[model samples]
Structures are given as C-alpha cells and as structure tokens.
Target: MFKILVIDRCYFTRTGMESWLNQTDLFPASFLVAALHNLMLAKEHIVQWQPDLVIADLHGFKNEIHHIQQLASLFSVCGDGIKVLLLESGEDAQLSDYFTQFNIEETLLKTASLDTLAQSIDAIVLSRPTRTEPKPAVPLLTRQEEKVLTLWMEGRSNQSIATKLSINGKTVYTYKRNIRMKLGMDNRFTPFLSLPDAIN
Candidate 1:
C-alpha cells in the first residue's frame, strides 16, 4: 500500500484530490490517504504518518517564502526518503527558484489539466524510492495533553486553558510543552494552523 498525504487549505481541493487519486485506474497499488487543510501542521503529520508521497498546494504559501523553506528542510532530512508534488498558482512562478534550490523537482501549476496532474503524480511515483522496512510508530499525545492542545488551538490563552481544564496554570503549560514535543515541534515560535480555524 502507498501512503499519501494531501495538504491543501481548500477543503474541496483536499478531498477532490484524494478522491480522484483513489478512484483512478492509473496505478494498481492501493493508497492509504490522509488529508489536512493546514500547512503548519504538515510537518507533524508527515513525520508521524511517514507517507510515501506528499501532494502539497503551495498557493497559500506564496507570500511566506520562509514557510516553504521550512517545509523543504523537513523533506531534506526525512529519515525514509519520500517524494513531493507541489501545486502552485500562476503567481508562484517566481518560487520555482526556491524549488530548484531545495532539490524539489516535481511541481505542477494549479490550473493544469487533470491529465497533466495525473502525469506528474505518475512520474513521482515511478521515481520514488522503495521502502525496505516499516518505520516505528511515533508516540501519541496523552488525553490531557490532547485536551490542552485542542483548547490552545482554539485561541485559548494558557491561563484560559488552565481555567477550562480546571488545572493549575503550570500544569497547562506542561501539557502544552509535552504536546509540542510529541508533535516534533520543539521550536516554541513555530507557527501552527489551528485545526478548527483552518478546516473551514
């Protein structure tokens, strides 16, 4: 089975891509697909899920070159190598240089025909490295940590989360730290797309 992650801020696009890829007869392999409408949480998902291929829409990151760089860095160091297919808008033409710099070779314009999209995916899949062994699963967040993260993702302040959870403020902070650590986001300043906010 091939694991594929679709990252696009558009709900329709994410679902549409997943559906199309699954329904098409272009590839005989089975696909285990996951969709995310947030770019910020992509690294976390990618690391934990260890997808064989990632289809990311770069339209949202046009003005955020640093965010693209960050993503490129993650792909560079991914333990088991993976392939990426980036979707970009017309305005993203200038960003091609960044792709070349990061060795990201497969990219397709968002307005490209479905046939072209399928071709790009086929090319990537054909070139992807075969995995010899399964990666060990990453640790999951504890229930309390998940609760704290849900609240924090809703724009709650640390104190607000503490009050909501009926826990001490310090405990809430600890939970937040643990959540971040488990998600492989050690950098406190790394931006995250609030799931609820980004989904819509």
Candidate 2:
C-alpha cells in the first residue's frame, strides 16, 4: 500500500486535500502529517518519515530554499520512484528555476479545484513504477524511524514530528543525530543540500 506524508503548518487549510484523498478509491494506502513551524524542523522531519510520497504546501515559507532543497534530497534518496507534489499559489514561470534545481516532478497551484488535485494524486500514485529490486535496507532506520523520515521529507520540525508520533523532543533529536551519522551528514553545515549534490 502507498504511504503519504502531508506537510503544512495550518492543518485547516489542508482540509480539501485530506478530504479528497479520503474519498478516493485509487489509493490503497494511508497518509499522515508532519507539520512544522519553520524550515529547520521540516528538514529534521524528512529524516524521520521516509514516506512513499510527499505533499508540501509552499505558502508561508516560500523564501526558504533550504527546506525545498531538503525535500529534493529526500526525493533523491528515495530515487525517482517516489513522487513529490508541490502546492503553491505562485506564478509558474517564477518556479521553473527552483523546480529545476530540486528536480520537482509536479506542481499544483493552490487555486486548483479539489477535483484536479484528486486527479493529480491519482495519476501520480497510479503511474508510479515498480521497483526492480528490493530497496536496500537503510541501517539507520527502524520502522518507526522510517515513518519519521517520511514526515521529515514533508518538512516537519522535531517537536511537531514528535507530537505526531507521540514521542518526545529529545528522542526526536537522537533520531536526527543518528540519521545524520548514518547518512554521513554529520560534518556538513546544511547536510541535506550538500549531501545530495555531492553524491550526484
């Protein structure tokens, strides 16, 4: 079953997306949230959830390029098989440069109808290619850790993710540190952005 992570600060605003997903029969899996107060938390959350797909709202934090880069890094780690959909209310032309830099697969304007959004989700999930081989077991993550990584990819913060998982802040930090060490991101200032670029 496909797993989804939704990242946005205001849960109320995401009602349309949530409602649409619930009413759809196309997806056999489920979804969860990893909301964040700021960009830093978002990066931390991605390392925690490790979701199959990420749906992000880029409204309040439009200027935070690092968060976008972190999302890009998660996409890279998951390979092209995982899908990421960006939700925004901005000019298409202006997002081209940024989308290219991050390799974003698709974008849905905030003004789009619920039907369009549902259809877009259906298309992405249905078109996902099957993996040729079993994905290598990522040593750093337990099942819970992987769930956290999925949420992290959606750009939620430590505290926010912890709340979603019913864990504490300190435990979340421990997992973040472990993930950094496991991914060899301990030394980099902005490891998410730097590591993906280095590997490529």
Candidate 2 structure quality by residue, lDDT tens digits, 58-150: 554566555445445545554564577887756645445656666566788778887787777767766764333433322344666666655
Alpha carbon RMSD to native, model 2? 9.0
The residue ranges of model 2 lying beyond 4 angstroms of the native Cα positions read: 24-38, 64-78, 129-200
Which ten contiguous residues of candidate 1 have the minimum total lDDT? 191-200
Number of clashing pairs per prediction, in order = 0, 17
User: How close is every model to the real structure, measured as TM-score?
Assistant: 0.66, 0.52
lDDT of each: 0.68, 0.59
Tens-digit per-residue lDDT, 20-48, candidate 1: 88874866555667777545456677767
Q: Could you tell me the lDDT of residue 137 within candidate 1?
A: 34
Question: lDDT of model 1 at residue 157?
Answer: 74
Q: Where is model 1 more than 4 Å wrong at Cα?
A: 24-26, 63-68, 78-80, 129-175, 185-200
